[model samples]
Target: MTTLSLHWPAYRLFPYERLLAIAEAIALLSSRQIAEDPESVTVTADRPAAAPRLTYFSAYQTPRTPPAPTVQHLIESETSGGSRRQSTRYSVHGLHEYKGKFNPQTARALLNAAGLPKHALVLDPFCGSGTTLIECAHSGFRAVGTDINPLAITIANAKAQALRCDPELLVAEAEAAFRAAGRSRRGRLLADVRGAYLHRWFDAPMLARLETLRAHIVERDPSVSEILLVIVSNLLREFSLQEPDDLRIRRRKSPPSERDPYQAFLEDTRALAANVRVVQRHTGVCNATSVRAHQGDMRTFATAAAARGMISNFDAAITSPPYAMALPYIDTQRLSLVWLGLVDPGTLPSLQAELIGSREFNGSPRSIWERKLVDNSERLPAAHAALCQRLLEMLGEQDGFRRQAVPSLLYRYLAGMRDSFLSVRSLLRPGAPFFLIVGHNHTVLGGHRIDMDTPALLSTLGETAGFVTERREPLQTYQRYGLHQKNAICREELLTLRAV
Candidate 1:
């Protein structure tokens, strides 16, 4: 192997000179550890002491205050071969933020540090809540995001694009949608709603106001319609009666309803409009495109729809594929999906897979997935297969136990993900990095544990797709959210696998 070192920014070959200095230290090539002598390392005089790493994962595992695991330690511990693969856990911290959803700070730091060329194409395939795209927009970098769920796509388009729009227009449209909704319902409270999931969660008045927003989103100005959808995408739970932030908790058979829904919508809309401006003024305009929202399965890249188009080439690929057996995104966001006509309420189990350890959060505790996770008990496979099996089983139970769909779906997800990675390889300038963040789903399938740390599994995938796993950031707990159930997946797998 050949190695050459050069100071960044000085080289003028890349934009992330500030980030590159640290990236180089963490991405050492050899198994040996290197320490910088005071003379050899140029420490910035103005910068504050390095921020202590923050604990990313929570709620699930027993928290031992996190210990520092350096890159060398991670490289040394990597198993060379397998007579029998070993079991281990890694804790790495302060990674680039997870796109959207619960993580915001990490997302912002990554954007702040990224100095990609103006209007460079940045892609986040697993854009949860549009954090990457949203941040990308704020950074003045052209970005694209894709997700399997239509609801998620809707939210992404709204937030990322709306951040650049006129706030006054957004507020006006939201108000109009609410008024139209009130008229359609004809003075009935929002609780007289038709949908089961919607009625169960939202207070009557909350729904009344939300319907108005939804109405406006469907019927209004090009800019704010999508923006309104994004608003409701976030507000569904608040308007709903689900205690805590968790949606899977059983809902009241019927909610009695309180909260002036219109006022609530108005308030949220006004706040969102203002926040968009704050972001614009704070970071300047992010360089993302006019949001592409596709509702098709990613695994179906075999279809023409999955084909990359006008914005075909990507400069860098940063994606976080769905965790194994976790995130029944379709089921969890059923209300918004149905309300927006993104998914069909009658066609239940629209998404089931080979996720062997996949389980929903039980309202009380314990998981349906755990029963399946530990079935084998004696031997464990990688988390990927276990999660897959659970998903396939769930799908089987739904449609007279259909067998083919799960394998096909599994092949599709893996193949689709692989294809997307390959496509990313094509788009990147040689040696440009593709930082893919993934979650390793662990569960008991056929009585064995499986850990699909993306680096190892994708070693071959990278080679086939003409890229290399340059550096790895270990997976740690992001949230202990899954702590009690599916006890196997206490740690999440987050990594930054750069291109060859």
Candidate 2:
């Protein structure tokens, strides 16, 4: 057996004050308003849930599995040719509304082919929307990956610059679909009466626009499908008359002037092109071939990656798995999935992380918080009075919402974390290190405080899966200088573990 460990003790908590100050500075430089209200921010003076500043550790107790499990051979391999060259930071700034969260310029993602040891051909099975793959392609690694959500695969593929995609072609087809639909008629010819959920989520004109978008996607170049889909995915939420970003289909009034799918497509094309320009300027290189994003489930990734000609071996892997029961992404994303043809109802559920957010979310509503109340009541024992805290407190300062939705939301989040990480270990190379970015959240469960130290939990979980505890590096997300640390973004522990 081989074991190796390294620690970066210099990593420290962001001085909350400095972090906010820097955030303000960034905002100022970008000509945006910086809010001073703590409630408006994700950060706070509150101390994190009680835990050792990381005092305990777990070691792998299981005998190492054979260097390569026969089960690992299930993944099939295919070969493709594409070279990578890392470029400097790419940026065409001040282009979008959400870019405020972080400096979208620097590239922090790393892959096995770039500079790691044994692990090559990296897989971010949990490639939450594909931030990692985009980096790998530019860094010039032969990267392979998968996602259950088709739209995710499309975005990652587009961002990764998969040579297969051709956006201009897709935009061309979308225009034709709109013309064929006679979108200009604007009379009783449009009927938006089926699918209660769809009716509830989108108004008549909005649905018409979406259908136009869908038809174009169907007839357009499959290669740049992601480019068009990215626009569609964003439009599903964007064109909504709701908060322009709200998801509670039940609330929020419709928009005054609903989008025209043809129009939206044009807008998305511009956004994508500009987004790429920004990416190119900031990162300095454009390597789309290094990214191979497919729409599939994480549990089945070993086979999926293999089909792409990737061996079960990958170098270093970095990702953030959905915490348990946090976001029933499959369910939450159902509207977009169905509209975009990412999944059908029958098989869609399987794409979610199995352990977390499964239909088997078997816990009392307040079990997690009840536990926290018991543990933290001593700290602000008064909070134990069955008080209803804002969801933002639980989700990050920015996403806070009303009281009623907290329980189900928290339950789902935890499940996401558990099942998501378990899936990650299967694709990683033996003795290879995997790093994750995770944060602590507020809530009570089963009369137990539910805060999980990802590195600590993974150390325990990895050993069972035949890995050794390597190192855990924690950083305050609210740090002003590097990374997106907004809305009480809290801290993300960089967990490094080696497959044994």
lDDT of 2 at 374: 36
Model 2 — TM-score against the truth? 0.59
Range of the 10 consecutive residues with the lowest summed lDDT in candidate 2: 71-80
Residue 89 of model 1, lDDT score: 15
Cα error, residue 497 of model 2, in Å, equals 0.8
TM-score of each: 0.61, 0.59
For model 1, how does the per-residue alpha-carbon lDDT over 54-153 read when each residue is reduced to its tens digit? 1111111112333333221222133212212111111111111122253432443344334355567776766655766654554456776766666667
What's the lDDT for all of these models? 0.47, 0.45
Candidate 1 to truth, TM: 0.61
